[model samples]
Target: MAATAAVAVACGAPAEEPAPEAPHGYVAGAEETAEVQSRLVVADAAGAVRVLDLATEEVVEAGRVDGVGSVTGDGRHAYLASDDGSVRIVDSGSWTVDHGDHTHYYRAAVREVGSVPGADPVAVHADQAVTALALADGTVALLDRARLDEGAVVELATIPRTPHRGPAVPYEGHVLASVAEPGQQFGSGVAVHDRAGAPVATIDEPCPALEGAAVTRRGVVFGCADGALLVSGSDGAFAGEKIPYPQAVTADERVREFRHRPGSALLTARAGEAGIWALDVTARTWTRHDTGPVAAVNSAGAGTALLTLTADGVLHALDPASGAELAATPLLTAPVAPGVRIEVDTSRAYVNDPAAGVIHEIDYADALRVARTFDLGGTPSRMVETGR
Candidate 1:
């Protein structure tokens, strides 16, 4: 990988003042790093938030929140939703900026920015200009992303509709949100809207019972009753295509939430207690790997083993191509707690054991080797990694 290109000067020429280094991928209060500066934003049931540095293993307090119902992250900031209908934003201080061919890593001081009245927020999505918070009441608040970076919670616009069950996705200067038909309780399809919250166009393909949504390199995906819907936009024109399951899937065994590395097309999710679901967005295919009683599932991307944690507290690495168990290791002694997750990066995968107050790090490529175990003092009920 090329970094910091050097310009040659003639041997006999007088040395000219070096041009000021360009401020490429620069953030106001962040320091660019030579390598990925990954950190975990972990929160306990009692609302205590902590930041664990992966490189130095140093844990630091990042303030506290209360009544946290759910937690989500956007590669940099952690969004914590409280039961009292509010959301708190915490800057993880580590992030990556990908320029297709090259990437840059940065680290800053972690802190809690502020809170917003979200009315029981379910998800948060962010892009360069907008940060959308989708609430359970079907109200989507579009916040200014630039203001959010400076510790402000400014809502630029609000899109109110019938109560739906998915996020209002920000994409290509527009927003893609789930839509519900009259008398329907859940979302039936997705619609595209301009930045001003005006409906622009609706995806022709119907996405019944939309439950989950994720942003990938190919486009934005929404989980439907029968299958998944992939939507992409270009120059204000949007289109959708359905990717149905290879076989019949019961409602209880459908893949809802998706997990994967940022910008990766390989999406993984628990397919009930039967197995794990892997969706290849680029190829428009879905593969189900039988991983019985899984607690969590994730993948680094294509060509990586599927990292799965079974309910019995065992971490198993399965070959994605054939669904064959390649390796396994027991990482926890206590019963696996609710909300356990397997966060995967290029080299390592992390699983939090709330009952044991520890997090296991596995080198996925090395036969699922246990590279490190972090004994956090408190229960990590919710955790998300930044700086991929």
Candidate 2:
């Protein structure tokens, strides 16, 4: 990792300076060879950040962050939301850059970056090399991705808070944040703000009791008890359009959280004791589906299918558009601990079976079959695939 390499360099002579230039983003192409290393970056109860490589089926104790129990990350960096008022950022050093015919990859020495202070950095969203943190106190902050890599940060904007728990999702030129009326205790709507923390519109649309939020290729979507608010556009101006749920999704049955991936406009959520709820962000439509008492759900292949891991240990893949069941396969028989999560990408879906200290990689396209089981060692309550 980067920390080890740093200590070794200190015992050697001063580093030599070299010239570099790449047409794309940071780390220049000439300096970035095909050294791509992707893995499942996890934060555990032991304050440790572990990396599991699927190819080698080996676990690497990357590093540790005190008080880190869960994590979220893009392919380049993993952001740990501490219970305290600060956020810890770790460079996963696993990323890919497309160069037309070939994709250039690099394996950076993973290291800890600077921390962002807040009332509680509940969520961190990264895009186009920019990072935005939403705090439990309703503080929304914008930061420079380059500065984060340098173990420092450039605060571009600090959207004032009103003491709420939610996320500030970043887009091309703007951010979407949950809005709370003054003197109110919780968030009741969603609003768009400029990079300077100015409101893009005069009015904030109601989304009382916002629970789940996701950033898709098209825009941002926030789950609400009533329905959902889909924010589109960018720059200093944006629009929040309501995507009301159908009559079938009554107050007794609504998803509080949603999960989605890049390129896909569909978001999957657990419809509280009911089943799965698919929200099409682009079309702003809702599709009713069931995963049979699922513990977790996720989307893959640009919203082609929805994957879920039932509480009964069965994995199911459903077509996202029509809510049709595509495949089903039993992967486990043990009862989950309310922490099992399902994650999917273009091809496969990965399930973390912490009780067995293993991860089930399912072939979703074929028939939701267990392709391989990786003995990751230790209990990983949650995990995110940091490999592209």
Number of the predicted model whose lDDT against the real structure is largest? 1
Off by over 4 Å in 2: 1-37, 55-58, 66-69, 83-85, 96-106, 117-119, 183-185, 200-204, 321-324
Per-residue C-alpha lDDT of model 2 across residues 1-388, encoded as one tens digit per residue: 8999998889786777776664664573223655555567776665777777665666677666666545777667777766675667776666767564777766555566766765366677777556778776678888887676665767887888688877777776767777777766557887667778887763356887777778776777777877888777744567777888886566657867788765478788888777888887777788877545678888874536788777778777777766678888877666876567787767777888877777888887778778998875676666777746
Query: In model 2, how large is the Cα lDDT of residue 378?
Result: 70
- Model 1 regions more than 4 Å off: 1-22
TM-score of each candidate structure, all chains considered together: 0.92, 0.83
Cα TM-score of candidate 2 = 0.83
Residue 167 lDDT in model 2?
A: 73
Query: What overall lDDT goes with each candidate model?
Result: 0.85, 0.72
Clashing pairs in 1: none
Across 232-263, the per-residue lDDT of candidate 1 in tens digits comes to 98899999999998999988788778889878
